[model samples]
Target chain A: MQADQSALQCNACGGLCYFSPERSALECLSCGECYDLGQPDDYLARDEFAHRPDVAEPEDNITPAQRTHQCQNCGGEVLFTGPALSAHCPYCNGPVVLVSGDAGYRTMALIPFRVDAAFAKRLAQKWAASRVACPAGLADVVAQGDVAGLYAPFWTFDSDEVVQYWANFVKPGGKAIRISSTKGQMKIAFDDMLMPASPHVTPLIRDGILHDFDPRDLKPYRAGYLAGFAAERHHQTVAEGIAANSADKDLLIRNHIKYKIDRTGVHGIRYLTDTSGIHYRRILLPVWILHYSYGGHAYKIAVSGIDGRTFGERPFARRRLALYSAAISACVIALGMAIGAAAAF
Target chain B: MLAETSPLFAAAALFGLSTYFGLIPIHKLIQMHEARHELRQGSASRLRRAGGWVVVALWLLTVMWCAVFIGDWWASGDYQAASERAWQRIGILAKLAASAGGVR
Candidate 1:
């Protein structure tokens, strides 16, 4: 595949432009002009079904770091140099998407950043301040931290599932409990089950900040939306994503079966699941990451760019916790002594 | 009366209460640290696990010590005294209730 490149430049001043979340358009850095990208194409064309055979398999020998693209505006060649698929040209400062030899998979859709960087930092500070066990000045330290906005890769899967199960339950009779076996089949349709496609975002951070993203807001993939922001392609394959999605589906199926049975005495559950009509789309999700250090230990906090929700690690205040424990102990002892004196009287 | 008045009983109660209150926050802190470590390293550190177990062992020892003391007090016939003291408190509460009823 050849490299697909587009240079986002301001028409008025011919300066570099970036996507501004507040304006929902490309904003030039030099003259502060906003260019409206016209309506996005329909997102349906990006969905690739597993049963389809016409789609070409990803190339095995294309190295991401070695790939390079020529800037359309300056004719300057820019090396990817990293796992990132989108970056600004150093020479001309034009935003570019280097799509050549990107393992055959392309980002089909993206959820643009709704919460800006300043708001994201405030969210992180509020989250840190709310932790009761955190150090006294942790929020102040977090306020000074720099937050970087990046579009992370993710996969959304849709499938139809048929689950068959057998279970035993106890039926209470007039005088005794009788055990009986039951068997049944259930059909479930799962839509847009999201899975992270980048290893840079750890599972803990992913699970912590992930919330329901509105499918209606998914705009068709456009390079202008990624202007002035860092973006990465999927390092994980569709097959690997499917395997992870299967584990999640199995847990969901078990919960559904348990809910359907509605018996606490049920035991020895056995089940089989058959899945079909599997469809997937590679998409980009926005996130803001803030890295900071406290007491010589470094920590990072992630904020969802769509909703500004924050989650991360912070250091505990040992002296304050010891004081709280001492106070509680004293109160417990005093209450006990008072009760004893009243009883003696 | 003897159980309530015994210094050993008071000491045991204080020790149990202090240990319970003191170790709970530390245990929670260690657990949070372990979770962060696992998030970074993909597995829990042995030292953190040992710290958690040490907290558990301390709590268990406190519970066992309190249990043994109570068992000894019961075997020494202090329960009878304790029961009498409880009844005395109940009598006082009943008298107070009767006086309040009369005033009403």
Candidate 2:
């Protein structure tokens, strides 16, 4: 339980992950074994991700990120804040990242955050207090836990890819499975597709962070954003983040292509990967990460301002089932009576 | 339903009164059910296109009904008379209501 007080190395994965969730004993995402968040290192170490987590990662239909441009050389994603032309793709073990978009060449537009560390601290505190349900360390979770505000490393990309897609669709009766494909050549110019430099923050989550931010008011990456914070460095490479965001970009491609084709149903997509090069913009996005303590345990959730989007799980409210069932029964009865009257008439 | 009721506030009111008096308990029961989530098994996406069309139709009809009201006012007796008393009075009322953001 003392390990819950301060940061400790995980015996399983050597990750600096906090023993969070209040309800569950410390379940190492990297190791997949649940332990006392209090005594996480007693168990010997082993790989946990042999199989994917039972819960599937949510799809990008929620919110997606924005990047500045496309990479021309290796078609790997790019996110350069300063004047850098190219970078290496850690994935394919090749140097393929290239800057080849308008935002890449010119130091154009930006809108930095007006909120300072004091404000962000207050915000984080308020956020932490709201999660009084979590057991991280009810009083000390937000009070003592490292709440420094540093500009976390990020790579923002913006690009417009002319995507083409073909999908299979069946009629109402499934009489014939016809292919309704589209070859759309439209420009989807967006500003901030942020991928967190830290491994702790998954590309999936960071991409969502950027997507949630309103593009209409994005300030250029500024140093002041780092004013008073502890920041995480990038452990996951741009290649990995690209792989994460690619799922979404492909979906965008599908939708744009579908718009061109103009149809409804789709059975499966033959994901034609990497059609367009991506432009890059390294940026800092504001997030209020809160640590909470419930019953002798800790939990955290990131509150995004880009939109009021939250990512974390608190157990379902106990009374929810009863309330839901009552509501459903009442509605069903009313609907039935109305239908019966209509039938009689 | 504006297109259907713009000219007959009286009829719309009558219907509204009838529904209220006749289905009061039924409606309450429906509300109760909705609060407790008695909805049939369907995701939001499933409900969207089906419900969206109903909303679209309702909006269109309402707008059309308002257009009828304007047409009737324009063709009234005062507008066609040598002394424009009735038409002018209505025009003044329309102007005042417009200024108040009530008519428009």
Candidate 3:
């Protein structure tokens, strides 16, 4: 059952962005700016996208899990081959039939998976080991679903720009702390800033599971990729991506510019501008996403197919936690005795 | 002979204190397991989902803040400054810790 759903509502401009894989951009249906797929040059917080599929297309001739169907919901393309599986369409950030698509999914620049399920399990176990306040049935939480592995499409952007920024410098003006008016500038060149272009890209909780794509790793879109599994389309757009990236590039350039200015001991700056160029590539990275609900919380964990980098939360073990806490406490008390003995010295 | 072991003792004492106080949170988390089991039968609530993250984030960042500042206090030579800052830190910690008891 395909449903129409979208999560992006631009608070700045009462607008909605649809991910267009054709251009690998988040096109603001309202505005024409293409937000490239992929993360900006310096992103700190993990982001999550609700992948939607083409549920708005009223023609229901395409069978579920049998053909690559356009969603009636978000108008994104996807492979819907199984009844038991559903995924976010990357183009519209909605649920879609994820089977196989032939409508032109260009499989190029693939990064093969380096991390395997064993590592994913290990990393997940380790991560669960850390979330102590996590529920007691941690093992069950990790066991809740079949982890799906797929190569998600990403659009990478590179750019050069002339950026100007204003910053404050804390200077030692006669020992009394004085904040100085600081202006700075720099030339920033961005390379390989990745954005998710595939409709229904994986969320941020997945980490370290990227594969190094080689030419040999690419495979054309085949229905078999969805025969036993599900597939998703990208919902993020190049326009939204570029806007975010542009802001980021501007900030980074300003930071470097500020550093350059600060190093010169000049507390003030001038009409700072950046001269920069941009380049990009389309890539498909390997990821294994396990989505399940436990304790009423929807938990999604990503395991890197390359470096075993993991992200997300799950239930915690009560008995194990108790034992650990007691052990740690006992160890601390024992050490406290040593401190007492030393204080005598 | 004991002087050689003094540092170890001091480290252990602090570790124990930290561990013990932290047990309150650990216990609460474990107790939360029963609630999760009960929740299985009911529909998942987005409120609870959001609350879980909110609580976790708050506690995590605060603990990190405490650990960093407290570590700084121990590591720095200015014990007076550290001690004074410790009071300021504890004041902030107390406000946060107090807020922890009353989450939906």
Candidate 4:
């Protein structure tokens, strides 16, 4: 299939342009011109493929592993390799956005990067410096590493669930404890339960920035959003994403039941859930990943590109911790001796 | 002198044992809390079980130490002296408690 490709260009100088987070617009690097990305088209909005049987199946026009697009501005060829639907033109540094022929599920919407690269790096460094019981100068080591902005693919689901539960409880009686059984049903509606579809995002990273993006801020997917940033294709299928989402929903239902049964001395909980009206959309969320080494150990730090929240692995100062333990032990021993002497008297 | 000092030495030894059995698990809990992000399910569960066992062991050790001390005093026919010392300690504790209560 032939994919339509175009590079955002500056009106004044006709130079290549890229999306600038600070300006929230497509800015030309040559002329420093900022172009407003006008209102997004409703046709490109989310849920276009919702409730469709062929949502997971590849379309007849799906692109192959390797394809080249002629740059509109420089007439140079831009090569997109291995699930990359967009890239910068190597010859002219133009931002190229492929309009169609995306492999797998197409991205419906995205929460664009609000935090720039420099700000993300600062946030990571600050997080490293604030860690307790870590080696000194750790932040300096982390500061030396470059922060890469990535658009990580995720699946957001909306569903309605009916949970029917049977529970037993104990009540105090005059002469004995009384056991009673109660049955009830609960209806729950979940909106935008997000599941990461990218392998690059670890569980810790997902947890740290799980609630960082505001759903209301999600914009219709535009190829210009891929400008000046790397975006990942969704690696997991809809069925796999649905499985993960169901696990989380089950936990939520259990907690809801427990809350409903609180103060009833509840035990022996058994429940069955009926889920329906499941709707999902594929989208991209922004993340900044930084890799750094401290004392021969490599660690990764992830900062939420939406809110700048940071979470990462840190190196512990074992020698300093051992010294602290020895000091604590001596103090405990001295306290023990004093108490023993007092008791003896 | 031996009779008076023996209880103190025993008490100190019990405290030493408590420290040995107690601090290591407590430290493990602290480490778990600090490195919670990196901890896997299997290792975290093992650490929690270790902590629970330490608590149970400490309680049993306390009860056993009291039982051994009282049994030794009873077997040696030193009950009179031990009882007198217990009453004196109780009185001192009561007085300290009263003072603390007044301060509060």
What is the TM-score of each predicted model, taking all chains together? 0.64, 0.40, 0.46, 0.64
**Candidate 1 clash pair list:** B1-B81
Chain A TM-scores of all predicted models: 0.72, 0.48, 0.53, 0.73
Query: Pairing residues by index, what is the TM-score of model 2?
Result: 0.40
Query: Which tens-of-lDDT digit does each residue in A1-345 have in candidate 4?
Result: 222125465678977677788988888878898987758564345552454333565432233423545446554333342233444533233455544433545567888888898999999999889876678899999999757667777877777789899887665434344677888999888777666675445555666654455567778866666677766666456677777555545655665676777634566778987777777778888888887877877677888888887877777776555555455544554554444334444
**Residue-by-residue lDDT tens digits, candidate 3, A105-168:** 3333444445555566666666655565566656566765446555566656666656666755
Ranked candidates (lDDT, high to low): 1, 4, 3, 2
Model 2 chain A scores worst on lDDT over the 10 consecutive residues at: A42-51
Best-to-worst TM-score order? 1, 4, 3, 2
Most accurate candidate by lDDT: 1
Writing each residue's lDDT as its tens digit, candidate 2 over B66-88 gives 32333343334122331233344
2 against 4, candidate with superior lDDT: 4
What tier of docking accuracy does candidate 2 attain?
A: incorrect
- A4: Cα error in model 4, Å: 6.2
- Here, model 2's chain A TM-score works out at 0.48
**Which residue pairs in candidate 4 collide?**
none
User: DockQ values for all predictions?
Assistant: 0.07, 0.02, 0.07, 0.07
**Which regions of candidate 4 are displaced past 4 Å?**
A1-5, A40-102, A166-184, A263-270, A320-345, B1-104
Candidate 2 segments exceeding 4 Å error: A1-113, A116-150, A170-191, A202-227, A235-240, A258-261, A271-277, A295-298, A303-313, A337-345, B1-104
